[model samples]
Target: MSDLTFENVTVRYGTRRRGLTAVDGADLTVPAGTVVGLVGESGSGKSTLARAAVGLTPVTGGRILLGGDPVHRIGGGGNPRPLQMVFQDPYSSLDPRMTIGDSIAEAVPRRVVRGSVARRAEVTRLLELVHLPTDGADRYPAELSGGQRQRVALARALAGRPEVVIADEITSALDVSIQGTVLNLVQDLRRQIGLSMLFISHNLAVVRYVSDIIAVMYLGRIVEYGSVDEVLGDPQHPYTRELLAAAPRPGGALLAVPDDDPALLAVADTEPADPHHPPPGCRFHPRCPVGPLVHPDRQVCLTSEPSATPHRHRAACHFAATTDSATLP
Candidate 1:
């Protein structure tokens, strides 16, 4: 496995003149054999970015590099591809008409699939790796429970022998009772196979449990990227603070959203600006807790975009350097 890098990637919908920019100049990485978690609210462009990496959605600009080469160069007909993705809805990801074994066999490497005996053995091995019963291969997707079907999905993905797997909310649709089982399997697979992954989820707790690094996305940009402790324990962005504080926990305080703070109020009380016409300067300024709209004016947020530092633990905010966790919301 090699490092996965996104350099100034952008995904746009509609025409060039009137388009919705789902991802805007986003830069990120998934180090070899490491899991990077991308967390953001709905419509924050997490999935769009994931799709771009796997060549599902066309990139409007910039590049998706696997190791040092362009990602698209290696994936084609009858090729041993290195990138794979597992979607959110297990019910819809699999084929109801195809038997589980056949579906899994389709993704098996060509050399192994050339023989019936080898194909069967490979299917059995993958099923067992994901903790599914070997007998499951003979059944259709309809015969399995949601959790069981998800395990099958994972097995199918593994059959391709991918180096990097993008899990897009893979556990969000499962029952809470079985969510842990899937999550545990993912961890075990990574530990056993040393897979590099880009794990996407809106659930903060889930992300923290499975990720080596955490990246926070807003609207169409990454506002903060850091280790779990740096982003969650000592957040350097106000939006990051609001996100951590808002997550439900017993006896924990919610963000102190003052009455006079329009930016913060706008996030809770109104719809965000349309993606086709995002607010200039800072796309997040309309809802920023410490933008120029607040008491002490930081007018730059309304006039120019803030750039992220080229460091491991950095944030894209003018006040990021001075944002003290001691006064957290």
Candidate 2:
């Protein structure tokens, strides 16, 4: 099984004396052959979590396991490198000097890179796997469009035959039309290969389209986690409701939340907690409309961090059971 599990993972940048904690005590898992979409704001640590999964970032506390083997600690060599990441900026990730074929070949394991003929054959196969023309392999990063570059990036990641793919907003840079095509390709690839994926994006609509499960992150924590329909259709956390309200709807370019809505206004005006020095207790409490403002029972949100209490789904909120997306102002 290619299950990816993060047990209370925390990622900090710089020295502990004066560093920023980007991710804090995050417990998540991407089960084998499933897509878990992690959605949040720009600084919500979604990308950081994805990076930690592939060993790109240091895990300051807890463990990151790939199929039950600890992959977090440096030089933990028991596990095969089963994780690969497809970055958001395809152009920046690719080498300007190297041809697409050579770039993909770089991901080929050392044993398989025995000869030029083998490398070329592998590159061709990967290009075909990502739905790219074999002739495209000879081109440079600058020579390709955003969509093509993204496809190339996916091809390179697939070269490793990764058990899990960390897709960090890979389609965000492309145009809307192109985004649909790339999303289709990704879903197709997942179904064809039965690959597990942690799809990270700020776009809830996009996440909803591709995810079997959805995890809603606010600041550095996952405030809500559940099946796509459970979390998106009937979000318990205030943040999740705000996100759904902000997402675009059919025939409506964007969900036009009434300007006078107190909940949406508070959400819009509030800045994400400072990563280096997050708020005490619940990080989202200060801006949470349903906390002290709407319910007296939720006053505890200002002084205590809520655990992931399971009800309809797992949500870290004291009054999650009483809260409803439809009732939010």
What's the true lDDT of residue 78 in model 1? Answer: 61
TM-scores for the candidates: 0.94, 0.91
Off by over 4 Å in 2: 72-80, 112-114, 253-271, 327-329
Which ten-residue region of model 1 has the weakest summed lDDT?
261-270
Candidate 2, residue 70: CA error in Å? 1.1
In terms of lDDT, which candidate is strongest?
1
* Cα RMSD of predicted structure 2: 2.8
Can you write out model 2's per-residue Cα lDDT over 1-329, one digit (the tens) per residue? 46888899899889879988888999888889999999998888999998888877878888888888885442223223488899999779899999999999888875545688998999998898888999888899999988999999998888876788899999888898999988998899887888789999998878988999999887778899999988977788877876776676777765455778776666667776677888877888767767764455766887889999855478998778777666432
88-161: candidate 1 lDDT, tens digit per residue: 99999999999999999999878536688888999999999999889868899999999998899888888888
Stretches > 4 Å off in candidate 1 = 251-270, 327-329
Query: Whole-model lDDT, candidate 1?
Result: 0.86
What lDDT is obtained when candidate 2 is compared to the true structure? 0.83
RMSD of each: 2.1, 2.8
- Candidate 2, residue 150: the lDDT equals 94
